[model samples]
Target: MNKKPNVAIVGATGMVGHAFLKVLEERNFPVKDIRLLASGRSKGKKIKFCGNDFKVEELVKGSFKDIDIALFSAGAAISKEFAPLAVKAGAVVVDNSSAFRMDPGVPLVVPEVNPKAIQRHKGIIANPNCSTIQMVVVLKPLHDAARIKRIVVSSYQSASGWGKEAVDQLWAETEQIIKSRIQHPGSSIKVDGVKKVLPAQIAFNVIPQIDVFLPNRYTKEEMKMVNETRKIMEDDSIKITATCVRVGVFISHAEAVNIETEKKLTPEEATEILRHSAGVEVIDDISKEKYPLPIDAAGKDASFVGRIRADESVENGLNLWIVSDNLRKGAALNAVQIAELLIK
Candidate 1:
């Protein structure tokens, strides 16, 4: 910790990787060195960081030599293969994949919520899922005042959560449909059966399932929200049910979260607490039609909360609408914040 650390960014050409560079620069992270890494196909690619271009190196078994920290945004398979090697080379890893998230020994950290979790890292720290990270940022402050009993959350996730291809396809399909409609007036198009990334058309529709369905009938993404929220909040018994849907949005994710707590808090009281909480921004003014939207949250670090109102059914029921850029605060910014925690 005496000097600036040398950083290595795995999957440096991807969306999350690009966000990591921006967050690091925007936050002015001290960097003695930076190594951009990716697959063989991306080797020799030029990436701009800190006002300079760095060539992308092919990721290899020995890529972590003399590295101080490694930020991983690759898929789970790649993380499962290379993350341990990074750790073995004495670099602390902040992984954005689900590979080690549920590992009891690995700390799942969100710097704003449970920063202490990072101190217990055995070398590899897991970043919570995108949806889970943004939600916990809003829920933690409220949970601290009134212990939450149950949560029912429905997510309107963006295409970027899947990958670059999903985002590209969303726009491509949208344009294709528009052109098709122009060429053939009042004609029905069979577009649902064709897709590059999703099973159905995402241009003018929403997909109910984000990941594969489990035997319990919940999608894997829904279960992730349930499990990751508990682990991040350090609560096991909190009942949570999630329904994740993929919307046609391109950047940020929005969620409708209903909370049941042991104690009551007026809407104004909850709004005040969230306004003062770290990494949270409150914009609940229903009279003005002001609330957190995906477009408003895009490229932002803070989680935006609004639609603050009481659920009249239960004693302490509250409804909140949370939004944050899935790529920034959810993945890359959180990883960068973890690095900041280590250095401080």
Candidate 2:
């Protein structure tokens, strides 16, 4: 058998980085040497892999010397700084940041939707935004079957998408609410819970913002889905709009998607296609109340599609809901899949 490739996971201590380890192991990808790279504070921390301890290394300019493929999930700034160095060192970089997604030369890839796009990469390939990734993966096959004229998406994103600090904020605020409930059973803020943390508390409430707002009033996360969908699907004519909101859930980014198709498809037809679609699972069954939920989808790799119905107002419109572990398929698993493509 051929030797397994040497791989490096940048930001190995972050949420997405930790998910990458699980995806790689679950898929049984051939990994000869796995280099775990993190920040200075995390360096020397032991990450056990295959029953052996691997010390995390601090990321530096020369860290990619012998790495064959680098999966980067640190952040956009770090990717902007070090991705090129990894490429120069002869490693194909699969970056999970927005730094290069819209770059004309770099391919924004979702393996299930556009694996062929990987062949056009110039050393660096970008994974689409978490919300965009699952939406497109579920929509692409249908779009290819019947052209998609317009797409409207609303995202219920988890705090973990913002990284560990945001996750901590959610948990802390939640615990505070629980304690308050126990102390003051009849208080006004009892069931509603706390509503402000970091300018807006996300305890038992949903915040209508996920990232910094742009001049157009849409958050950066919304713009990512709008632009990145066109680039990844290779269809600039597909009109897209999005509203991303942060939810109180611990994991899984869920989306309420509505698409106007050039041709009509019944709910059954759509569900049939989604069930067999690559990397997607159709879990719509109203009679038995079997549908995808955020808690049910947490930690799973596949994007779940449910609540499929035809829009009565529009001529050829379909409405659906989708959920997936944003940290996995949205970030880590997609980046790791790109590395697998390079190895092939």
Candidate 3:
């Protein structure tokens, strides 16, 4: 424990994987060495970490032989296959996937919310879904203060949440739309390029479906919020529902969250509590036309919250507008923070 850990980053070339490297360097996480592991297609690819370049190695069964921490952001399938192997090899895994999130043993975590849960990890710590991560960070303080009973959240997630391909498709389709508008003069263009990354057009519109539809008609992404929030808070009785939408933005995620608490808290009171909450930034100044936005939170670590008000429909309800860089605090930064907590 005295020495710096040898870290292995699985999926080192993907969007979240790339962010992991940036967050590690920015936070100055003590690292004895870094091993960049990716798919065969990415093998021998050079990636920069801590101001130096490192070669990406093809991830194999024995890749975690001497690794201390394996930060996984590869998709669920990859994580399902490799994470257990990494754990078997004595490397603690911080997985960013839906694979093990709900498993009773896997402690789903957002460092700002339930950090003590880190000590309970059997071997793998599941990083909660990006949308869930931001919402829970904002909720932790309020929930603690007023005791949240029910939560309804709608997320305007960015294309970057899907990874590099979705971001590329968004811009590519946007460029095509502008070109078509200019060339054809008053004609609309179909978002053909975006369909591959998302089921519907994402350039000028928002797609309400994220992940596949479940038997309950709620999409998987929505259910992740419902389940992950309960798990992280260690309160299964808390009622929660979510609707996740994919927007054309390239970074950050924005959510409108309404909470019904046991005790009443005014907008001013709610704002004061969030101002002192860890990893939360309040930007509610309507006079200046100020509030949290996706672009405002891009590349930042804090969850930006604003639009604090009371939900008039319910007696003890309060509302919030939460925004954050999904890739940073919502994904990579949270994983790295867990690694930091692990060694401490």
Off by over 4 Å in 2: 1-3, 182-199
The residue-by-residue lDDT of candidate 1 on 57-89, one tens digit each, is: 999999999999999998999999999999999
TM-score (all chains, Cα) for each model: 0.96, 0.94, 0.96
**Model 3 lDDT per residue over 1-344, tens place:** 32499999999999999999999999999999999999999999999887899999999999998899999998999999999999999999999988999999888888888998888898899999999998889899998999999999999999999989888888877888777664433443455534566877677878999989999999999999998899999999999989999988999999999999999989999999999999999999999999998987999999999999989998999989999999999899999999999988
Clashing pairs in 2: 196-201, 197-200, 197-201
TM value for model 3 = 0.96
In Å, residue 214's CA in model 1 sits off its true spot by 1.3
Q: In candidate 1, which residue ranges exceed 4 Å CA deviation?
A: 182-195
Could you tell me which 10 consecutive residues in candidate 2 have the lowest summed lDDT? 188-197
What lDDT score goes with residue 103 in model 3? 93
Best-to-worst order by TM-score is: 3, 1, 2
Candidate 1, residue 301: CA error in Å?
A: 1.0
Which consecutive 10 residues in model 1 have the weakest lDDT in total? Answer: 182-191
Write down the lDDT that model 3 would get.
Answer: 0.91
- Model 2: per-residue lDDT, tens digit, 65-183? 87888899999999999999999998889999899999999999999988998889889999989999999899998998889999999999988888887787788767777876643
